[model samples]
Target chain A: MDDARRGAIEDFLRAASGDPALRITGAALLSGGAIQQNWALDVVLHGAPEAWVLRTDNAATLAVSLPRAAEYALLRAARAADVTVPEPLFLCKDPAIAGAPFFVMRRVAGIAAGHRVVKSATLGGGRDALARALGQELARIHSIKPPRADLGFLGAAPADAGLAFITAQRAALDRQSRPRPALEWGLRHMERTAPSPVPTRLTHNDFRTGNIMVDEAGITAVLDWEFAGWGDPAADLGWLCARCWRFGNVAQEAGGIGPREALYAGYGDVDDARVRWWELGAHIRWATIAIDQAERHISGVETSLELALTGHMVPELELQVLRMVETAHA
Target chain B: MHEPPDAANLLETARALLLAELLPALPEAQKMNARMIANAIAIAARAARDNSTFPTPPEADLIRAGAYDPGTPGHDAAVAMLMDIARARCAVSSPRALDD
Candidate 1:
């Protein structure tokens, strides 16, 4: 933490809390989130101590990500809907305050590493219950529909969300310098079998095991709302069940936490066919994103070993996509 | 000409030394990066040993152009070609993922 940024945060905290004596004890950067940066802050207001997290954009970010204000509003909406999200407190739009736009939210505790989360039998009420809780939490997130003034920036819900995704992916493929015949073929299959769009709802576009926070009791919070938008609810469900997101626990389909049935049971219903379709789409989406991450490293935009290795994951994801599409046709 | 130690052998020896000597000496924070370095070395060694080229099958362009339906002759062939390519990729990236 630099002096100028610390002074700005103190000023902002004083204003937000209306406490002239409020002081920040410490602030440390937290790990994870390749696209965003999170800072853990310790603060004392009128002798009452609290911990908060400051989330802001990194200098380099993905092309399709939402702005900080949008993400703040989404977090507020999710919290209001009884979803287990960190309570968003204040949004600081002035880049001078933190070198970028940012928001402060109450911090929650949990480990979210995919490898540990999948292997641990002691965290979050174990695998089956945790999977169910996630399903139920996703249901609550989906309950938040559009037509709100705050989330208006998300744009109108597409008439056919699946087809819209396919089209966007195809456009992305076109933008790539190298040809991707497998991806193109997968896109064609998706176009041919695109399901009729159901009623659109708020979807957490990146809901998976690693994005979720869990402790001994259960899920502490669902993190990462930057990709949340109005789309097919089934997209979230399928994304949760996608094999790539399973994180090596191939048998436990629901984010490598539990079976598909357990997840659907928590969600209160199951649309097996639609969920399967979106699972196929998930693989395609992941493959494209992996390539993008690799390009980010390769092109000198943001050089990172993790990003480069993520690019290597494309083949495994593509294989999954191919196998699923084959089974779908059969 | 280069001496008896080939590129693959050199990479393997370097990787062995890295894992056995330098990796354990690394702090906890740097362990993951050390492991990734070793993994990269292993991938390079495997790629060097298996030097077969993976050319995109001729049917790939036709598939991309929407020339064949699911049951058609070229369609299955294209899928097979893609599967083979995927397998080759897995051989270098994560051979274990293909084991199951």
Candidate 2:
């Protein structure tokens, strides 16, 4: 952490926690998410303070996450409507408070198994049920209506969001020194017959199995609201069931365990044309993110084995993009 | 029914992925992906052994799921195009598919 940023965060934490004597004792990075940094922060309060999680925008960040303030509002909105989410305790947008924007939220505890949840014995017999539950939760999220102010902040819709995504990605990848035949082909496919125009909605751009917290009962909360925005809701569904997000079980396409039936069944009417369009859009989106990630790795943006692996998924996802496009037209 | 892949053929495919695909990119950090690709290939080989008759990977999913119209004249052509990429990168091979 930058020392100045650290001090600002310290001051913000002291004031936000309502404990002047509270000071950060320990901080360690958590696993699972990379875009928004989750620092397991331990604070000793003067009176009484619980273990709190600090989510901040790292200097090195991905484009997908919602801006900190936006995410805070999103969490507040979801929480009010009975959607389980990390309680948005305080949002600090003042750069004076944190190096960059950050938020303090009630830490939720549970396993969000990216790789094992698909066929886990813990989820025994509950596979279909859990899938249905996830769908319902997503439905609730999609049902939300943001105020004109929030919608304005979220920005205007791209005429062809999918094509816009493809063009942006092409521009970024064209600068790279690599063989990107698969990406090129996928982009062409997306461009040839783009997703049809559809009504955009409040979408959790990263809603998927891996991003959800599940326990014995079922999905507890959806994490990673950074990607939340106003877009095609089908993009969310397609992203959830996308080939890459399924982790180990590609066979279980419905967010790894359930079929699209349960998900769409809950999503209701699913707006097939829109969903198919967004499905194609989501592929382009993921592939673009992947290529950018790969570029990051190759450029030494964030040097980690994991980052390199993320970069490699670009080709695989491009293939999926083609599949989604073909799936749309087929 | 799935056709059983010959053990030797599976091994050969594994070798090719390891050597042609993974080995060349043996930069220190690339091992994770190299291994993942290797593992995915192994699992795919196991699946292949059980059923050598690979379903068209992106087949029926597109048509049935509204990915495209099966009745479209060029649908088969599209499938063939997708298969070419799959055969090259995904290491899927068929004996009797003379056209592909």
Candidate 3:
């Protein structure tokens, strides 16, 4: 950040916090958000040191992700529902303050990397506790249903979540340059075996290991509300258990952290069939996303080796989708 | 007609060199990028060696039309054929995925 922007943010914080004496001791960019920018801020508040994270839009935004202001409101709603999330402090809509609209929130400490989180047995107080805690957190998020005035931007809850997902995935696939036959088969299978309609609930659409923060005690916060919206509550369950998110720990079906029963034990009373149906959809969802990420590089919109390799991940995901459909038939 | 060290051979040798020498010398942050490059090179090498051109049929249309729905006349046959194609692609793209 430049000095001018830094000064503008400092002034905004001073007024927002009602602490004229507050001063920013340090500011550094936090890594790992390719589509967004998160800056770690160290400030002395009330004569004590405090750490906060400032989230802002990147140069470009994905079509489906929520804006900064909506994300701030989501954090507040999740907090109100007792879902573990960083406390949203303030939102600055003025682009002049930071070159884009931004929001600040309390920073929670933990490892959010998928590989490290799945490998470390010490983190999240062992696998069972972590998985169960995640299930409980998801249930709390689902408790925030639609018809909410604050979450009006999410539009109406889909009458049939299964069909809605299939339609969305098909549309995304159509936009791609290549025809994914395996993905098409998977979608067709999902369409034929669509699950019965369930109540619409707020879903943390990207709820998985890499998106959640885990400490030794347990989950500290669930991060990444960009893809969140009202959909099948079990979609979160399926997303958590998706084979791709297992990070090679395929034995542990629940986020590569613990058994499915343990996670269900935390959430209380979930239909296994519904979860399996959504799990199938999750594979298709991830495969489509991987292709899109790769397209960002292939189309020269933004080039990165990581994005290029992500394109390669589709075959594996496709294989899984085929296998899963086979097993479902059996 | 091609040279002795063909495109696939050159890619394989370059990948081996990257792992054996350049990878160790790279900084921690750049090492991940190096690994990704090596992975991409391996995939490219495999693709270069595989000459089979598997043209994908308009199965999406058929599938969407419910032509291959379960219990239909060609349902099982269509699925088995699709699985074969999926395996063939994985063989060149990610053979590890076909392990199970």
lDDT of 1 by residue, A208-227 (tens): 98999999999999999888
In TM-score terms, candidate 2 sits at 0.71
**Residue by residue across B5-99, what tens digits does model 3's lDDT show?**
99999999999999999999999988978988999999999999997766555467777778888889988877887778777888888888888
Ranking by DockQ: 3, 1, 2
In candidate 2 chain A, what residue range of length 10 has the lowest lDDT sum?
A178-187
Model 3: per-residue Cα lDDT at residue B73: 93
The predicted structure with the larger TM-score, 1 or 2, is 1
Q: How far is B25's C-alpha from truth in model 1 (Å)? A: 2.0
Per residue, candidate 2 scores C-alpha lDDT tens digits across A1-330 of: 566766677787778767888877767677636576787777777865566678877677876556888888888888877777888888888766666777888777777867767767456237777777777888788777544464466777665555566667677656666545445545555566565756556778888877888877777668988777766567788788776677757677677877777777766777665565555556666767766676676788887555655554554555565565556655
Q: Estimate each model's TM-score.
A: 0.96, 0.71, 0.96
Interface root-mean-square deviation, each candidate: 1.9, 10.3, 1.5
Between candidates 2 and 3, the lDDT winner: 3
Instruction: Indicate the DockQ of the complex predicted as candidate 3.
Output: 0.65
CA displacement after TM-score superposition, residue A254 of candidate 2 (Å) = 1.6
